[model samples]
Target: MKAVLFANTDWYLYNFRRSLAMSLLRAGYDVLLISPDGPYGPRLRELGLRWEPLPMERRSLNVLRESALLLHLVRMLRREQPDVVHGFTIKCAVYGSLAAKMAGIPARINAVAGMGYVFTSDQLKARLLRPVVRGLLKLALGGEQGRLILQNSDDVKLFRQAALVEPAHIRLIRGSGVDCGKFAGNSPRKNREGATRILLASRMLWDKGIGEYIAALRLLRNRGYTVQAMLAGTPDPGNPAAIPEQTLREWVDEGTVTWLGHVDDMNALLASVDIVVLPSYREGLPRTLVEAAACALPLITTDVPGCREVVADGVDGLLVPVRSVEPLAQAMRQLLDDPALARRLGEAARTKARNYFDERIVIERTLGVYAELCGPGQEARQRRYG
Candidate 1:
């Protein structure tokens, strides 16, 4: 068996889908990864998978360039002739499905992870681009050989309402799952001051509520609150919504919070933080929150779709209004002031991780999706549908 996974970035394959790719290999499928070559591409090679760097622009405005990308992918897919092709994010899903279809690949999978800024931003440009994006998505996912996978029910409804997918073609598999055992609780990092430690681990994107986090920290600092706050993760230069480096440097200079850029030891960092928070405006089940929960860290997030799925109001974490600085500060203060409640929430979060967000469960479910589309099943499906 042969499979190809297409994504926008090499980091995505390494960080998010390594487990799934490794599973494909174990199940006896030769895996080929297609993405823009980056530092992480070599890491994927180290894992024994063939790598092909596609010239995919994450935020491109040129239609000619994108069409060229599609043509290139089609030629590659036609040459490789894989049995199954999986694409992540909007561009990859759209272009990958088109390329695979043109190449006569038998099965295709497209993952809609959060719908991106095209749906989230309220700017005029985004509004104008919606119809075009919708049209492109319809073309990408509207086919017998493809299945559209979403992380949250909200996104599922959005696509269904847009008539982008049929009920039979839609699948709901929550965020790329996290390892429960590896992230089990460890003592949080403490300094001599014995202050509560809070961390936000995600790309430094405005939509991820990075600015709101800094504002909340400033508010806490003004109130003379002695809590330690850290922002872990680096800005994604490819993403248009990424916080400007200058702004990040300004925040660092202000000294309201510490910025730990790209902490490689995620488990250790989570173990060391008393609380984890993500004030994202929206998400397709943010992996940062799930990983933080798996590490037994109490969560503080907005009361939005993907976030609400993981937190039960006051049960496993506190839910605050989106984009509000005061409420965010209050929620963090609540967790910091009440150690007992924090512990209860942390424990509940771990239980939730085991029940719903285990990496193994997600991998199995994804493999099952792949299985239904490939091998003898592929022949049967083709005969039945063709």
Candidate 2:
């Protein structure tokens, strides 16, 4: 049997679904990756999967381009003729599902990583586009051959409420996955008398709460709290909600937060930091927080769907209201001043990562979804689902 996975970017495919690809390959299925070519594309090829580039814009609104993309996807699906096709991210899921249906593929899975900017935004364009996307998803995700995979129950409920997908067709897989063993906890660094270091690692987007994070940091500084905060991500020029380079530079210049730009080594970086923060407006599941949890780092995040799913109140991390700078600052304040509490939360986070958010769990569950759709077909019987 053959499996084709569609992702928006090669980096996302590599960073998120490598384990799943290996798992499928080990199960004797030919695994192929469909994504835009980038630096990470060759790396995926090196890892023993076939890479096929598809020209898809990340934030384009042109009707002609999108229609052309859909046609190209249909042609590719017809050509590949794989037994299974799974799509990640919004555009891929919507387009892949439709293309697969058009190509007469028997099995389809669309992973709605998040509702994305359209559903999350309060702007008029987003509000106008919301119903259109809902209508498209409802049409694209319908039929016996198609299934919807979501990371959070909130998204599932939203889809159902919008009449997008039936309850039976949706699978609640927590995250893309994170390697528990790879992100091991630190060996307790020496105590310092200076400021506690906190990090916010995500693509520089306004919806990821970069603005709120800076505000919180500024609040801390104004209150005479000596906490070192860093924004360890680069601006995403492709995203509509991206934080501009000028704004990021101004924050650094104004002493609001240190900008580390793009981070390559998250494990090592998480180890050095005392706390991790993700004030994202929404997510399927924040991979950064999961990695931080695996690294046994305490978290300060928004009390939204994906964030709440990974963290319990006062257990492994602190959850604050979304877009609220005071509470965000207060949560960071709690961790920075209380070393013992931070250590306790970090340890609990590690345990949570091991017990629940491990990559193995995600891979097995996803493969099971594939198996369920395939029935007693060519899939190996030894899969964890079987």
Candidate 3:
């Protein structure tokens, strides 16, 4: 059997879906990855998997470019002719599924990582785009041969209410689960012991609560708390919410936070910090929180959909209101001042991660989905729907 994984960015395959590919290969299925060419493309090649480059634009709203992209994907799907095609992210899922259908592919799967900003508003664009996307999704997932996978219940409920997908076709999975064993608890990094270090690992986007995090940091500093802040991850230039490099540099210079831009060793970084913070306005399920929990670090995050799934309020971490600085500051201060409380929370978090978000579980479940789609069941599905 053969499977093709389609994504908008090469980084998505590299960072998150590599395990799934490896699992497929181990299960004796040929795996092919299709994404825009990048530095990570060669790495995928080195993994003995087939790699195809597509000209995908991540944040463009250009109709002509997107149509061209759809044409390219359709051609690729016809040529490669994989048994099953799985699409990730928003645009990829929309376009890839449509192309796979056009090519008469037997199995199609769409993984909705997050609802994203497009579905978060009541603007004319949102109103217009939602129906268009929903129409495309309905066409792609309407048949018995396709499945729609979501990361959180909130997204599942929202899309169901919107009538974007049939309830029977939708399946739920945890945010690409983390490797608890790999990110297991470790002693804090040897450092200036007197200070508290808080780390926020996410893209530099306004909706990610970068502004709120900075404001909370300033508030904590003003209150004379011995604190240090770190921000990691790259900025998406095409994304409207991206923070300017100059502003980020200014924050670093002002000593408000340490900017460790795009560190590969996230587990080590999480180990070094006293607290893991993600004040994101929303999430599909932030992998950073799962990694931190695997490392047995306590969390401070917003009371948003994806964030809430990871942190159990006061049990393993604290939840503050989305986009609010005061609540964030208060939560951070409470953890910083109360060492015993932080330690207890961290232990609780590690325990929870082991029980729920093990990476092996995610890989197994994902492979099961692939198997169901490509196995003998496909014949029955086609007979029923075709």
Candidate 4:
């Protein structure tokens, strides 16, 4: 069977969905990836799978452009005529699912990695646009062949209560499973001679708790904590909630946090850090926390859906309320002040990640979903592919 996966950008497919794609390939399915071109376009071609570039504007709200893109996608779906069409990210989930349905695709899977800013906001834009967004989702996933995959229960509950999706069609899968082996365990924690390094890896956005993190850092600095904060990720100018470059630079100049900019080596950076932090307002399942756990680095994250699922309160890491610097700082201090506690938490995190967040488990569960949707022929295809 041929499976065509559609998402916003090629980089997202490379970083997050590569495992799932490879899993599909190994299971004997013809895998085709559709997304806008990125640096990873060559890499995806090298993987021996078909990569189709479909121009998509990641941040544009232009209705005409979006409609044109949707028509283009519909044309592609009709031409490809895959057995199943899998959609990722918010835009793809809505538009791609609709196009696939229109093209008479047999099966469609809409993976809601996170609810994202649309569900989390009450701003003018959200208030004006939410009903349309929710309605589109309903139209896309209303049928029998549609399956809605959620990464966190909170999002599932919200969507169900809001009547955006039927409860019966929803399936919960834990965050894109972490590669425990790739993010190996860390050694025993040793006291930092003078400076303690804290790392935050996320797209620089206001809603991602960037402001709160900076406030917490300032508070810590005033309190004379031997700490230095480093941020790794590009500032997304397209996102409405993105942090301004000038503001980020001001913080850097003020010694609030060191902007490492975009770094390719997250594993190495996590290894070097004393503690990992993600103060994001919300998430589907934060890859940063999973990577941190795999690296045996204790985390300081918000008590939101995806973040809470991974960190068991005081077990593997600490959880603070969303957008609250006081609680964030307190959690950070707890880990920094007592090295023993941090080490204990980190060790526990590694164990939990290995047991629950293994990539193999995710692949198996996803394949099972495909089997349930497509029925017996999937096994035959798997055998043939093997």
Candidate 5:
């Protein structure tokens, strides 16, 4: 069998789904990666996987351009003729599913990581596009040959409530998965120097609660706390909620937070930090928190959909109200002042990571999704539906 995985950026395919691709290859299935060209494309190729660049603009709204891109995908799919086509994220999922159907592909899988900007943002453009995107999702996501994968229960509920896809077709997979072996370690890095280091590693987007994190840190500083806060990851220009480069620079200049832009070595970075936090307004299950969990680091994240999935309040991590700076600061202070509590939470988090978010478990489940469409059961499904 041949599997084609598509995402908006090569970086996503490289960092997030490389293990899945390798697993498919080991299983004797041909795998081809599709994404917008980037530096990571060569890195993916270096891994002995086949990769093809597609003309995809993540934030583009031009109807002509989008139509042309759809045509291009259809043509490519016709030529490649893969047994299964799996698309990740919003745009890729919609377009890949439509193109796959147009090209008469046998199996289609669309992974909606999150509702994304259209549902998350309150801007006028986003507000207007919400209904239109929903319509497109409803149309493109249907059919016996297709399966829709949602990361969290909230998303599954939302999609079911909206009737975007058949309830029976929706699959709940937590995340892309983390390599627990790579992240888990016996010797976690300790801050020998004073000051509790709190790290939030994710794309620097306002929707991610970056502003709130900074404000909370400021509040901590005002209260005479020696907490060192670090922001790892760069601004995503393609995202509507992306923080401006100047804004990040100003924050760094003001010493509100240390900006470690685009960290390549997350394990090393996680080791150095004392606590991990991602106050994202929402997520499809942020990998940063999972990695932190594997590293046995205490976590602080908002009580939102994907964030809550990785944390149980007062169990594995601290949960704060969304977009509230004071409550966020209180959580940070509680963790900072209580070393025993932090250690206890960190231990529980690692246990959760090993049990749920490990890569092997996720990869196997994803392959099982493919099996629903490509395995011998597919023939029976076709006969029953026909």
Candidate 6:
């Protein structure tokens, strides 16, 4: 079987879904990865995976360019004629499905990671585009050959409520999946003398609650709590909500946060930090929190959709109100003050990661989807799902 994995950026494919690609190869599928050109394309090729670049502008609204891109996809699909086309994220999912349909592909898998900028942003532009995007989604996600993969139940609910796709066609897959073996072996903090290090690992975006995190850090400082605020990952230039590099530099200079730009080795970084925090407004089951959980690090994240999916309140980790500074600060303070509580939470988190968020489980589930949809002469099964 041949599978084509498509995404908006090469970096996303390299970092987030590399394990899934490798699993496909192991299963004797000819895997081809497609994304816009970037440094990571060569890295993927180095992994013995076939990677091709397709032109896509993340922030483009030009209809002519978008139409041309769709045409290009249609031509490529007709040429490659893969058994299954699996697309990650919103734009890729829609375009890949549309093109796959046009090219008469056997199966399509559209992974909607989150309710992205078009649905989440309160900006006028986003608001204006929402209905149009919804219409496109309805068109793209229809029919028996295509299946929609949602990361969290909340997204599943939202999609159902909006009547975007058939309930039977939607599948809940927790995340891209974390590598437990690789991210494991973080010991709980004990007898630490210096400032408590709180790390937030994500792209620097306003919607990610970077402002609230900074505000919470300031609140901690004002309360005379000595702590080190660290940020991993750089601003995403493609995202409209991305915080600028200059602003990040300014925060670093003023001692508000120590910004570690675009960290490749997250395991080492997670091991160094005492606590992991992601006050994101929303997510598609954040890889950072799951990776931290795999490393047995206590977490603090928002109570919103995807964030809540990983951390049960006061169970695996703490959950604070979204976009709130005081509650976030309070949660951080609590974790920092009580070592025993933190240790208990971290231990539980690791257990949860092994049970639910392991990459092996995800790969099995995903491959099952492909087999169900693309298996030779499964007419009865297709009818049941359809």
TM-score of each: 0.96, 0.95, 0.95, 0.95, 0.98, 0.97
* Model 6 per-residue lDDT tens digits across residues 1-386: 89999999999999988999999999999999999999999999999999999988988899999998999999998989888899998999889999998887748899999989998899999999999999999998888778899999999999999988989989999998888999766766677779888999888899999999999999999999988889988878888899999998989999999998888888788888889999998999999999999988899999999999999999999999988999999999999788889999999999999999999998889888888787867566545643
Q: How far out, in Å, is residue 314 in model 6?
A: 0.7
Q: How many backbone clashes does candidate 3 have?
A: 0
lDDT comparing candidate 5 with the true structure: 0.91
Candidate 2 error regions (>4 Å): 185-190, 377-386
Which model scores highest in lDDT? Answer: 5
lDDT of each: 0.86, 0.86, 0.83, 0.84, 0.91, 0.90
Measured on C-alpha atoms, candidate 3 has an lDDT of 0.83
- Model 2 Cα lDDT, one tens digit per residue, 182-239: 8764633447556788899999999999899988888888888987889898877777
Report the number of clashing residue pairs per model: 1, 0, 0, 0, 0, 0
The clash tally of candidate 4 reads 0
The list of candidate 6 runs beyond 4 A from truth reads 378-386
Best by TM-score: 5
Error of 1 at 36 (Å): 0.3
**Tens-digit lDDT track for model 1 on 1-386?**
89999999999999999889999999999899989979999999998888889887888889899889989999999889888889999888888988887888858898878978888888787889899989988887876778888998888888888899777889899888888778775544445256778898899989998889989998888888987788998889877788887888888887877889988889888877789999999999988888888877789999987888889888999999999999999998898788788888988887898899899988888888887788466787877663
Per-model root-mean-square deviation over C-alphas: 1.6, 3.3, 1.8, 3.5, 1.3, 1.7
lDDT of 5 by residue, 240-312 (tens): 9999999999998999999999999998888888998899998999999999999999999999999999999
Q: Which ranges of candidate 4 are over 4 A from the true structure?
A: 377-386
Better of 2 and 4 by TM-score: 2
Looking at candidate 6, what is the lDDT of residue 306?
A: 95
Worst 10 residues of 3 by lDDT: 184-193
TM-score of 4: 0.95
Q: How much does candidate 2 score in TM-score?
A: 0.95
- Which pairs in model 3 have colliding backbones? none
Instruction: Enumerate residue pairs that collide in model 1.
Output: 189-272
